[model samples]
Target: MSITLVLVVVMAVLYAAGVYQMLERSLTRILIGFLLVGNATNILILLMAGRSGLAPFVTDDGRSYEQIAEEMADPLPQALILTAIVITFGVSAFLLAMIYRRWRLANADQVENDETDASVREDAAGISAQTTADDRALDVLLESSDEGTAAKHGESAMTDDRKEDR
Candidate 1:
């Protein structure tokens, strides 16, 4: 097969895989999907550039400037690809940081569904604002009670109680 055809096929595969991966709940898979998509886009830009030719550098050859221009490869696509690479790297890094933060906060790699999202949708569809406010207050109250219980018992009390049972 021709190189262009090969690249086109690869691009199509990457796009399909990327879309599938992006739909997953795992943040790592989403990041990988983003990378695949970026690489596929870069390949698409390269394919649009046509066949490779002489570099755009001006030489002291006797050939006219117009002839040299005709023989030279387009530089814009390469430059665009380079910019896209940098942007992809930056975005990937940001996503990685967010994943790490999420793992630290929730102790899980997969993104959990937010209960608040459902509640917000319900509220938008006519649920009263007072109900949402009461839910938030209940959450805060439960959290404070849990923290108070932990503080009142302390680590030493739990360890001693366990030792007695053993």
Candidate 2:
């Protein structure tokens, strides 16, 4: 019946669900799992904060600062929660990246499923292969029979002036 008891139960349920979802293959479910776990962690921190009290900020109610300090809520727990939130954000990014990479590794195939994928990959490979250091297409195009005297730094002197042989 107590609020803390109810919160503890809720936290337990959240943690259980989050961990279960984390075991699943779907990225979206994993993301949900991360979020749930993060929230449950926040709740755990809150429970560890002890009994709640008035806000820490001082008010002009004719009370001395010394007398009010005793009832003020502990800022340390709040600060710890903020730190946890930042850590969760950073951890979530890495976790998502790891899950995505794993999914890609497991799902990706060397065998192209369709003609479009095959053609695109083949064309890309061919284009990149030509631009390698051994080919030296630019050097050949820029070379002049006159030797030492090279072309000036202008568009007309560049390889664009002539058709590139593939």
Candidate 3:
């Protein structure tokens, strides 16, 4: 098989596995997913760069500048991929640290859904009455405050000035 086809297949597999792992609740699995995705992205960049050629630097040979430019590989994609690798490494390190701290505090590798999320789901499913009550209370409070403020301030000095200008 051709190298491009092989790389494409590998990239596809990496992306598939990465997305699947990312959907899991475990931090380790998420990290693995990130790594897989990063590798897949690098491969994609390489594939898009087309066939490799000579290095992109000045040479002592007698080749013309235009010839050198034509023969040299495109540097931008390689540079972008290198920068992406460094950024990914830094972010991965930070995530690993955060995961370690979370593990230390919670003593668990799997993340549990937050109570707020559970409450939202319960509200959505019409299984919790408190949600509606809380929302109504907040709406009433906001309406009262708006009316009180409007009555107290009438109109701001800025609005009066703008009206005079018009």
Candidate 4:
């Protein structure tokens, strides 16, 4: 039932490093952070799970149900660890693919600042909503067009369609 000091410290270090790495701009760093955090979480769950004992499925011939239950190791923490491992693997794989693609396409691992984020910052800085509905609609239309959303249904997305439509 007692948790070792060393394990607790390791978990703490993992969490700290994971969080710090997660904040980095590099996709590889983020993946490492995610893995660290997942491992730390697994460690935490294991520590909190208490002493390991006999499997819950086994039943002694003469032992009472209460005694069997007391000796049974909790399955919840083990399941959680398994689930976390799976989620980490899937997400890391996706991140790896994205990193590879970025590297292949641009020869860079650094993520560029998205223009949408910049525009959102500008809106938050000061955009008056006190204007008329017509102005707001026009603004939405213009912004969507600028982003190539083609808010207008008649606008064809492909070159061939464009010739026919226009």
Candidate 5:
């Protein structure tokens, strides 16, 4: 097959893979899809530069050639791809960091939308401020008393009772 056709096929496959990956739930997979898409774009650009019989750079024969003279791969596309790669790396790193932070906070990978209406209703009804300082203090006191009673009975007391009943 011609180089152009081969490149076009490669680009199409990469694009399809990228789209499929983007549809996945995992953020990591989405990032991989983005990278694939970026690569496909670079490949398209390189293909469009047109095929020449020789490289664009100077030769020892001293023909004094200008850039983009013949069949050699274009250096500009390569440079642009490198820059795009760096940018994509930075963006992917930032996205991963954001996902990590969200996971750490919520203990889940999926994004959760907030129920603002419920929150607003609670706020309007003064439910948000219903738990007073005294109630909180009492909860703490009760919890401490429960723990003290447990400690007094010994940690294995409950387990021992179950064994005796059995």
Candidate 6:
């Protein structure tokens, strides 16, 4: 098969794996997904440049320029990829730091199962309810002189609270 075709297939597989890993709840899988995407992007750049040829430095009778320019592999993509890799590395490090914090808080590397999910859901619901109730009371107190205004303010506050929760 052609190199371009092979590279395309590889990039597709990497993208799929990255998506799957990102969907996982564990932070580690998400970081790995990001890494896979970074490498795949680099490979795509390489494929775009086509196959490498002999260095363009040497000339007839073995003459060469001391400050050869075009002889190197397309240095632009390589330079771009190098910068991307560094940025990816920094992002990965930050992700690791966040994961470490989560682990410290939960004392586990793996994400907890249904019980944890349920508790988080319940806590979120309770917080939502409390915030809504508080907003309603505030709306009544602040707009108590006008019935229509109080109702509108209460409705707006609940909508704002929902958006904040999201």
**C-alpha local distance difference test of each model:** 0.91, 0.81, 0.89, 0.84, 0.77, 0.79
Number of the top lDDT candidate = 1
- lDDT digits (tens) for residues 1-166 of candidate 1: 8889999999999999999999999999999999999999999999998879899999988999999999999999999999999999999999999999998998988988799998888878675677788899998898678667878877333356656886
Tens-place lDDT digits, model 6, residues 35-143: 8988888888777775575565455655455444445456576678788889989999998998899889988667667998899999999999999999999987865
Q: Pairing residues by index, what is the TM-score of model 5?
A: 0.55
**Model 3 agreement with the true structure over 45-87: per-residue lDDT tens digits:** 9999988999899787997899898889999999989998998
- The parts of candidate 4 lying over 4 Å away from their true place are 1-3, 119-166
TM-score of each: 0.71, 0.54, 0.73, 0.66, 0.55, 0.55
Residue 102 CA displacement from its true place in model 2, Å: 5.1
Candidate 2 C-alpha lDDT tens digits along 74-152: 9999999999999999988987787678668877312225889889999999888877854686666546522334334
On TM-score, who's better, 2 or 5? 5
Between candidates 3 and 6, the TM-score winner: 3
Error of 4 at 134 (Å): 28
- Candidate 5, residues 83-159, lDDT tens digits: the string is 87788789888888987887788787764546997788878667646667668989889867876888897854335
* Model 5, residue pairs in steric clash: 52-70, 52-71, 53-71, 54-72
lDDT of 6 at 9: 97
What count of clashes does model 4 give?
A: 0
For candidate 3, list the clashing residue pairs, or say none. Answer: none
What is the model-wide C-alpha lDDT for candidate 5?
0.77
- For candidate 2, the lDDT comes to 0.81
Report lDDT (Cα) of residue 160, candidate 3: 62
> For model 1, how many clashes?
0
Of candidates 3 and 1, the better by lDDT: 1
